[model samples]
Target: MADRSPEVAEDVDVVVVGAGILGIYQLYRAREAGFTVRLLEQGNGVGGTWYWNRYPGCRFDSESYTYGYLFSEELWRDWEWSEEFAGQPETERYLNHVTDRFDLRRHIRFGSKVVAAVWDEESAGWTLNTEDGHIVRARHFVSTTGVLSVPQFPDVPGREDFAGEAYHTGLWPKEPVDFRGKRVAVIGTGSSGVQIAPAIADEVATLTVYQRTPSWATPLNNKPISAERQAELKAEFASIKETLEASNVGFLHEAHDRKTFEDTPEEREAFYEKIWRSPGFAKMTTNYTDMMLDDEANAEFCAFLEKKIRSLVDDEETADKLIPRNHAYGGLRPPFVTGYFEMFNKPHVELVSLREEPITRVTETGVETAKGLREYDIIVWATGFDFGTGALRRMGVTGTDGLELTEKWADGPITWIGVMASGFPNLFFPGGPHGAAGNNPRYGGTQVDFVTELLVHARDHGKRRIEVPRHAEEAWMTMIENFRQYSRFEEHGQYYGGNTAGKAKAFLLNPGGKPKMMEAIGEAVSSGYQGFLS
Candidate 1:
């Protein structure tokens, strides 16, 4: 609900929503292009996900440098990441530094969330009203609302009855959460759960981790960047940027050119071991090309993972439970972990399998299940989000046909290369649904650049209305969904809007990855932007 008593409407050429990494970049592009841009963010600060998700061990799985903006050579040389993988604090600080360094903070409206956005037929623009009284009219409305902004909590009985402190990893507090000598319970075995469990295991007096499903864990193997390596990276900034843009998955690491069957039995073992030792998403991305697609190849990798977990954890059953059996190795988003399996080996830590003893409710003290009520001083909900299109669906945006965005995307999201929806005139939803499938910022930046190009085209052509024709939207959606068949993401699960209850199970990503997306954009540009109707 917006506040009553509105202020005078502020007109701008563009209004970019969500002041995350992508939002800040959009602001910079619009400003530099001579457009009066105003960025509205719900949070008090710039770091959107990093600002909220401060849970312990929350960090970048991607290479720190590759994930950061490669637009500016000066920026690449100036900022030195402490480690190969950066934690929440470092990531947040870096984003804030970038924002301040680029002078993007002034154009940002902190604490203002866009609640309602309406397309104006007569004005050929958009009227955006924030949660507060502020109003803005803009020719272009770009939403970098982001894929994982909205957190989703599972349906558990008596959730509010718990008197102890509860926190969702997606919305962690600014202040430090004390787990020392306290009985702590973590729910879900997703990426966040995998990270936080090992992090707090030593500190908590008794740590009970409730798992609904198992997650395949790989070593992050993160190390501090040496001074010499930093200098080398700085010197090779141009090549690095070129490599990232040219990459299929937007990662620095290149996949093995060979297929699974190309190598002999012993050779496969050596390669699997190499991938196991590799950090972050390298296990999946740098593995044999057929590892993601072929059942036998994926199983071979999973066997190695199972063996690794068994070796790490003392208990065989616990180790088996830690390894995913139902899904493929790279099917669901696997957690690249640090001591995740070994956390269960700790004397104070315990694992609770929901399959064996299902959780009945959350009592005042802790979670209760078929076994009994386990008392905990604090409960951490590591449950994931309604990823991709969650935030945009909640914006209450009315499109050209006087239908809300929620309704437009009710069946599923339909967009032109994940940039613009058909009925949404002059509205751009970048970095939300149907965009990136990997290395978010890298893929997200490409979409932002496309939107910026569209705006530039509009300005040059003296056209205000920018709409994705229904035919274009349909064609794009069809292509991306077809692309999903070959992707690493599990066909089901949250990848297809299955995370949120009753949401349409539609593909929300461009699984053809960066190359295919760029191809689509190139086609649109070559055809004189005919896909977009004004």
Candidate 2:
């Protein structure tokens, strides 16, 4: 399905830059709007993030049913998810199914990684140069290169010179990695580390997890969907679509209608215990509404989680290490797992807290800490990506009058609707900063739909270009910055583009979530796509 054209098309009305969920849909919408489109994908197949991050135990933190596209009810009902939290293999298969079902593969040119995109104002089109020596010219360019596309290695000495086989979870190899009977060391305890640690725990001779900070985690309680449950999902497709569209969090979990202290202490304990067993994001969505906003309420929940972790792990000291003391329960994005803490009880699995003894370097065989050197057959770098703007900045995109995208966004990105930035005519970057970040597909889909509509408007008005006016971009930036005070992630460095050194500390996610995004988009549409000059 992934084919590289020997004689590439000289021109197209729209050129989509990825083969992910957004890219696939963008192609469909563009073709429907009477535009010739070509989708460029770097990977050999569909599923951008899911296809690449195929490391052990990788799966959906969002519910399996909720994560799928809502473009068609027929598509939704036909495909079935095996579990509440679908694993990587199943998720990849689902995306492939969607691609083929919609007959989108023919339009996609896989292995076509866009290296540089230059805008020509005279022609009012973009000249895209791919990694494998192909030039695609198009009137419009839409970048669906997702937020987590770029893989970043830690700044540890001797990391590259390591003699052992090392792999970052984000860019895992296609062929199976051998771990059986081998000593494995996984660095970083974020979402990927939490999942892969327990998965390879029994396989490896010994598993050592290096932690910089302990993330507050809840149980996934993942389970197979019964035939009855599947039928119910199909039957509830309409309601599911409605709730997902209207939801701020992009999930269908029933929200609690009361504050944390509305119920007595014992009642609150019972409520916490009930949601503690619920699957995936239900822990956050269905919890007391005040859990995120109020400090006292979050403390109560964190206390309950601490006691629960203590109960699961046999070693008291090991259990204490797992509990996060600095950040509150919902301060940073919490990881949901099946046996992240329970794996520590396994005799072969050990916890290496970087705080007590920091890692000085990565040796030829393994990681070296202040305490001593620990050798391993493999070093799994579960370290995350350069987050929001990393992939786009690396693409060498130049806009009006030789303005590089990285240079324009050097301070921070300024987008009218989290998609179109000023001085970048006919170039829209979705699935990155300013677009909704947390629950990607649904929220990102919102911006995706807007871009399509704007394309239609441009075509109808006999316009060859579209750019957010400077005034509109300024107003949008103000709104995005104003909403920053409402976010729970002020201390969470990664969300603010603060994790990677030298990267601008800008809020990469929409602080207002879907509701506010929808509101501003509604105004733009009503005003005949206001402030869009062509």
Q: Global lDDT for candidate 1?
A: 0.86
Question: What's the distance in Å from true for residue 101, model 2?
Answer: 1.2
**Global CA lDDT of candidate 2, please?**
0.87
Q: Write the per-residue lDDT of candidate 2 for residues 374-417, one digit (tens) a residue.
A: 99999999989898788888888999999999889988777776
Candidate 1 residue runs with Cα over 4 Å from true position: 1-6, 531-533
Cα lDDT computed for each candidate against the true fold:
0.86, 0.87
Instruction: Give every collision pair in model 2.
Output: none
Q: TM-score for each prediction? A: 0.97, 0.97
| Clash count (model 2, backbone only) | 0
For model 1, state the Cα shift of residue 91 in Å. Answer: 0.9
